[model samples]
Target chain A: MAENPTPTPARPRDAAIGTGLGRVLLLVYGIFALSASARALVQISSHFSEAPLAYLLSGFAGLVYIAATVGLAIGGERGRILALVSCSIELLGVLVVGTLSIADAVAFPDDTVWSHYGSGYGYVPLVLPFIGLWWLWRNRPRP
Target chain B: MNGPLSLATIVVALVLGVWYVIRCALNKAPSNTDLWSMLGLGLLVVVLVVVAIVGLFGPDRPADWTTFVGYLITTIAFAPVGVYLARLEPTRWGLLILAVAALTLPVLVLRLQQIAEVTSG
Candidate 1:
């Protein structure tokens, strides 16, 4: 595509902590971080005993989002590794959780972020990990 | 959420979504005016959230008051967050952020309505 002719000045390799695109991803990741964590906070505070499994899963998803945000915000070798691992886990989490939620409804009495491919959140949670992974892959250190 | 205010926010958001998508099609970053327009939309959202907050005092208050509050915070913050991110890129992606936020607002509003529907009464 003729779009995006100018490469971002801040290359991911150099670990320039903040680029425009990084800023954008930070916003999105930040939102997810806030939402997931907030969801967990509310769920746990009101009724932790209702469904410990679902509540814990929601908190885990929030942590992954927070990790991804920090990784993208940090932007270096370590950051890359952090982002890579978190996004990979996120992908697996979403796929497995989505399937499990559908296959066995009794287990998931309430919704986690990844339940049913994040259908509750319009599947953005499902798609976000893929995009996060792609961005990290694109910016991976060259051999 | 089921009120005119929520509907207005959703409709405005959708219209803005289309506008931003068109701007992206043209490969243009958000201009100063665009940012201002976003801020204006943010004002509208603020009003909507305020109204929703007032609704909380009514006897029809939803059972899930805490979750309703959570959505209120998110809805109000949405536009400014978009503006902040859009300012950073100065490219089509900036507009895309706006587009994403605009599209997401409707969902947030819907969620608010859903939570509010399960009232204690």
Candidate 2:
């Protein structure tokens, strides 16, 4: 943490994934990772028969969030690609699940993280992927 | 639960959340006071969780005890985790880290209250 009187050189694009607002995204993703996984664990363990599909989806959502968090934390070319895929999946999952949960409530007897566009957890689930993708795109390497 | 301690923690967190976000928006790094305030919040959370634990042994224990405990762990860890990340970044984003953590603490407390309300009949 020594202060360098001279200006530091510009950092490479590899470190872009975790700079500026990307750090905020990382914290949010980490929160979702914990919440989604913990919720899935409770649902699957406590009453698996009640809503197996929903519980499994919750587990999947948790994994996606975990990947996104890791990808953002480890900023580099690999991390960018990892985050891109995870964000894309997150976006699709929320949209598909959100629409289906609304259209066919019977099928979604229980709620996953994406159910009803994440109404239970606020609309963050729906909005998070877009921000994540934008961050990834903004940080994409320019050759 | 809806205890005074929980209410206090939520209020303090929200107030600090607003302050931190504003600081970040103004492009200020998390200063020493800002970081210390976060640590103070963490200490308050510790007290709140400890009280909740004591309440768990009361006559009207929550039916979903496991979930309640899970939330307690999350709530307690929230602030310190933010502080750790904030220290690492040493920039405006560090303040945002505090802002996000502070914002999330209230939600965690509210969730804890909901879970605690479902007592065994």
Best by DockQ: 2
Model 2, span A1-143: residue lDDT tens: 45568976654464544376777787788889989999999999999999889999999999999998888777677888888899999999999999999999998999999999998888999999998888777777888
What CAPRI-style quality would you assign to candidate 1? Answer: acceptable
In the predicted model 2, the residue pairs found to clash are none
The sequence of per-residue lDDT tens digits that candidate 1 reaches over residues B1-121 is 5488788888988999889989988999998877887888899999888878887988899898888998999899999988987876788878878987888888888888899889886
Instruction: Give lDDT: candidate 1, residue A2.
Output: 46
**DockQ values, each candidate:** 0.41, 0.67
lDDT score at residue B19, model 2, on the 0-100 scale: 100
lDDT of 1 at A98: 98
Off by over 4 Å in 1: A1-17
| Candidate-wise lDDT, in order | 0.85, 0.88
DockQ of 2: 0.67
For each candidate in turn, give its C-alpha RMSD to the true structure in angstroms: 4.3, 2.8
DockQ of 1: 0.41
Interface RMSD of each: 5.8, 1.1
**Candidate 1 structure quality by residue, lDDT tens digits, A1-143:** 14467776665553424555556567678889988999999999999999999999999999999998888778788888898899898999999999999999999999999999999887988888888888887677787
